[model samples]
Target: MIDLQTKLVGLIGKPLEHSLSPWMHNETYTRLGLNMAYLPIEVLENDLETVINGIRKMNFIGFNVTIPHKISIIPYLDDIDPLAKQIGSVNTITCCNGFLKGYNTDGEGFVSYLETSQGINCSDKVFLIMGSGGASRAIAMTLAARKAKKIYLFNRTIEKAKQLASEIMSYYDCICQAKNLDDTTLKALIKKADVLINTTSVGLYPNIDQTPVKYDLLSSHLIVADIIYNPLHTRLLQEAKEKGCGIVTGEGMFVNQGAKAFAIWTKQPAPYSMMKRVLEEKLI
Candidate 1:
């Protein structure tokens, strides 16, 4: 009883079996009575070009990129959204008029979710971001653009952190600094931070016990946010919560970013309630 005329949309990445995009998008399609099917395409690093070309040739309307492919797929794209280009990564892509255009909804989604869900204003907050990967870049840049008082990035590797911080400072003309993730420095940063965000994949499903920062570094004054949703409540967030700090999970970011991407492709408002319900059902 399935429609033969359904359009195709999906996510492309290596090891995509763990993704929740298909469920999220399919639920929206079913609720809205749209003839669309979302899929997860497991693409290998060596076969990125071939997979992209294949998608272009097929009837797929769009696709989401994740992990190792986010930045690497940029050069293969025919066009890139300015914001995505500035962020140096793309998590969403749309096919229009036979051309693939890349976009980074992660930043917009993260900022919007923080404002609406937590009600934590970013105007003058000193934000401390852990990790210097794509998600960190997007979040840091968004905070800087919003005129955050100051932004600091901590990473195990000093050079990588410094590089990301320098880029943000240059791009946004804001006070951005990078530091090595040492006990003393982390303790100091945690004490002074109003909002602490983790953009690394440390506490994801398979590695649920690991947290980038120690529990001793956390304080009740800090607002901790983790971008890992699979296990939902990460150890870092749990510890922060135990310390009475406000916490936000990665689920908000996932839903918001997916909604934004859906809007970009369909040119309509996403059914947020339906999307969230579907995810909850699956999680249960």
Candidate 2:
């Protein structure tokens, strides 16, 4: 346990006190008898470059990116996965031969969770995604790639939403619409959406009382999802469940994404079930 040969992997971003990634990954490593340890490092915006440089010289297998750092970390990477490049976000990174390559597992993770756990396919679903950040870019692009019928993006800044929608429409055969967070527009779009996802940090830990969408808007037919797992059931998911809507929490995505990153780092199939169990045990 105190050996110097233990390899390291971790998550790098600000406000990491709420992250369960270390628990999920470390448990998987323990069960598999892998000499690996996971850590969480909170890096400020200005110190991101310094931290990345330090990680490059250290004994790091790789690390996961989150929140504000996902997009910003791209410039520091040696290479990027084609899909992650297209999505303009990087959530996972693998270091090999002193070279750091970035990849975005968020979209694939969300898609996997949606199909297996929620029993929903992207092809026939119309999605309304809240927030236009890195996570939004990854999820929207992935859904469009899967041939989602239509996608609506709502964000505080209309331009970012439009930019992401335009990027999706340019590369994928999907009808992607973007708009400002207007009540009337949200109401009309929610009525047509089959799945509603919250990719914002509004309902994350410490700010547990905040929510991105109005509670009254959730309908019984919609499958509502939030990507904030710390609370398990966020205000959005709680309201959606109370309104009789189907619900998907952030845990599925978190576990799925971490599993993918694990495989990338170890060159072995990740123990997905065990990873999921670890996160659920802590979160649920």
Candidate 3:
């Protein structure tokens, strides 16, 4: 059905061989009867500028940004949405008539996932985040804006966590603390945390056994959330479940963000259910 009129959209990132965005977006387009094609484009860091310039010249509707490009791509963009600007990261982009605008759906999308799946509010909640990357930054900023009581961050590099905590505290007026991840500190923090978020790729596919925290430390009162969708159920979630703790996978986060991007590109209500189902099937 593709003709001269068919539109093209894609995801751009290094190591995109594992991405499910193409399957999810293309299936959604098919079900909605939209003449748009979605695919994954692997672009190395050094080639980002050239690729971006090519995007400007092409007839592409838009493309999703990922990994190292999220933060680094900001300068090349013509404009950036407020949320993306504040987070200093962009995961979604809108390309229209040579004008490229960047936006970050990660914050709202993750919050939406939390609300939809757990019926939980970030207001006055205590969170333990296990990373200081772009994903962690967006999630932290959004949770802070939600007026979360406290966000305890732990990263392999303590300085990165401290920097994120300082930014979150200064920008959003929330209490954020940076701490080193160790058996002693993790156990203490878990006892007080209402939720634990894994923003890293520890339990991602091909390394399914790696977990950020030991399941033995988990409690029934804690809610474990991970941002890896390939496996649907990460080792962290499995361990959380073993302790009768509430758990959420990254599937909802991934789908919710895609829904936001879909709306941005098409100016139509995304087929949310179909997109999620497509992703689920692909993950399985």
Write candidate 1's Cα lDDT for 1-284 as tens digits: 24667778889887877788888888778888898888888888999999988888877778899988999999999999887988899999998655899999998888889878888678878999999888988888888888888999988777988998888888786899998888899898787889999998888888899998898889999889998898889999999999999999888888889999889888898877778778878776
The local distance difference test score of each candidate is: 0.87, 0.90, 0.90
Model 3: lDDT equals 0.90
lDDT (10s digit) by residue, model 2, range 166-243: 999999999999978988889888999999999988988878988898887778999999988878899999999999
**Which parts of model 2 are misplaced by more than 4 Å?**
none
In model 3, the Cα lDDT at residue 9 comes to 91
Candidate 1, position 239, lDDT: 96
List TM-scores for all candidates, in order: 0.96, 0.93, 0.97
Worst 10 residues of 3 by lDDT: 115-124
Q: Which stretches of candidate 1 lie over 4 Å from their true place?
A: 1-4
Give the RMSD in angstroms, all C-alphas superposed, for model 1: 1.4
* Tens-digit lDDT string for candidate 3 (101-211): 999999889988997799888886899999998999999998988899899999999999999999888788789999997989999999999999999879888899999
At residue 269, what lDDT does model 1 achieve? 88
